[model samples]
Target: MNGAANIDQGLGVSIDLRATPKPGSFYRGKRHAGLIDVDQKGAFPVSQYWEPIYHDDTNEIILDPDEFYILASREAVTIPASHAAEMVPFNPLVGEFRCIMRAFSTRLWHE
Candidate 1:
C-alpha cells in the first residue's frame, strides 16, 4: 500500500470514505451546484463504486491502485486529558486507522 505515515505518531484510521460519490444523491435537494457538508458522508453505493476490489455482501470497500479516498471512523477513541498517544499502524496498508494527522498530535483528545 502506498500511504503517508509518521512512525512517532499514531496511525490514522477511518471508517468511511466518499468514493465515486452518487451523482443522484447530490442533485436531489438543493438543485444548486457544488457540494454540501453532508455529501462527504461516504454515501457511495455499490453501483457508483469503481474500486477493483469490493465486498458486495460485507459492505467493505477497497480503493484501486494509487487512488485516494475520504475515510470515516468506525468507532470513537479518546485520549485522556493531558495525555498523549501515538497511533500504531495496523495491517501495514489497509483499514481506517492510517495516518492523516492534520489536527492530530498531543493535546486534549479526539473523537
Candidate 2:
C-alpha cells in the first residue's frame, strides 16, 4: 500500500493517512543535550530546543545534515489502543530513507 492507504484486517482498522502537510509544523533541533536531568521536572517547551523551520520562496524545506528536524508527516496516523505501530526505516518503493524514534524526558507533550 501507499503512504495514504488504509489497511483492513478482520476486526481491526488501520490508520488513515492525510496528503497535506500541516502549516507551521516543522521544527529543527538546535543541539543535542547529551544528558537530561531526570530529577528536574518542569515545563519543557519544544520551542526551547526546536526552532521553526524556514522554507524558501518555493515553500520547500531543505534539510541540513548536521541538524535534526522534527518533520510533520503529511500522513495522519491513529493507532488503536489494542494495537501498536512501528516505523519502517526504508521502503523499497519510496527509495532510501531513515526513521528514528526517540523518547523524550519531559511531562509536556506536543503533536
Candidate 3:
C-alpha cells in the first residue's frame, strides 16, 4: 500500500521511508560494474559493502552529500500481471537527486 494519503495527477503515489523509524544503510566510494557471471551472486565487489546507517533521536537519517545509498520503500508494492509500474527516480520539486537501479543495488545519490 502507498503511504501517501492521496494519489497525484500523474497517477503516482509517494512512498515515504522516513515516515517510519527504521535504520537504513548506505555505500560509499566510487561506483563500477565489471564483467559478472549471471550464475554467480556478488561476483565482483562494487564500491564499499553496505554500511549501516543510524537515525538521530528525532528519527531522522542523516545522509552525506555526494554519497550513494540504497533505500527501500516502506510499503511492498504489488502490480497485476497485466499491469506494470515504473519507478520515477527523482522529483525536482521534492529535491535534486538521482537513483540508478543496477544488478547489485538501487543506488540513490542525494545532492
Candidate 4:
C-alpha cells in the first residue's frame, strides 16, 4: 500500500544515508527478488500480478534513484494455524529502506 501520510510528508527532504539513521533491513529470502524491465516483451502478468524480468546489455536490473520496482519474494512464510497477520512496512520516514506488497485489484497480496 502506498502510504498516504508518507507521501504527504517526504515531499522534498533530499534522502541520503549520510544521516546515519537507524538502519532497516529487508528479509530477502533464498530466492531473493528480480526486477521487471521496461523493455520486457511477451504476455503481461496482469492476472498473476507478477512483474517481468528486467535485463540490459549487462543482463542486470538497473536501479534508478528514488524509483520503486515490483518484486517477487521467495521467502518462506509459515503462519500459525490460529494466528492472523498483516504486512506492515518498517518505516517510510527513514526512506533509507521501505517495502510495499501490492497485488492485483482482485486481491491485496498474492503468492
lDDT, candidate 4, equals: 0.36
Residue-wise C-alpha lDDT for candidate 2, range 1-111, written one tens digit per residue: 457445553223221123334443566776864444544455455666668765545656666656776665444555557975655444565444343332332344332
Name the lDDT value of residue 59 in candidate 3: 54
Measured by lDDT, the strongest candidate is: 2
Model 4, residue 80: what's the lDDT?
Answer: 53
Error of 3 at 66 (Å): 1.5
Ranking by TM-score: 2, 3, 1, 4
Q: How would the candidate models be sorted by lDDT, starting from the highest?
A: 2, 3, 1, 4
Error of 1 at 55 (Å): 8.3
Of candidate 4, the 10-residue stretch with the lowest lDDT total is 21-30
lDDT of each: 0.38, 0.51, 0.47, 0.36
lDDT of 1 at 35: 36
What value does the lDDT take at residue 16 in candidate 1?
A: 40
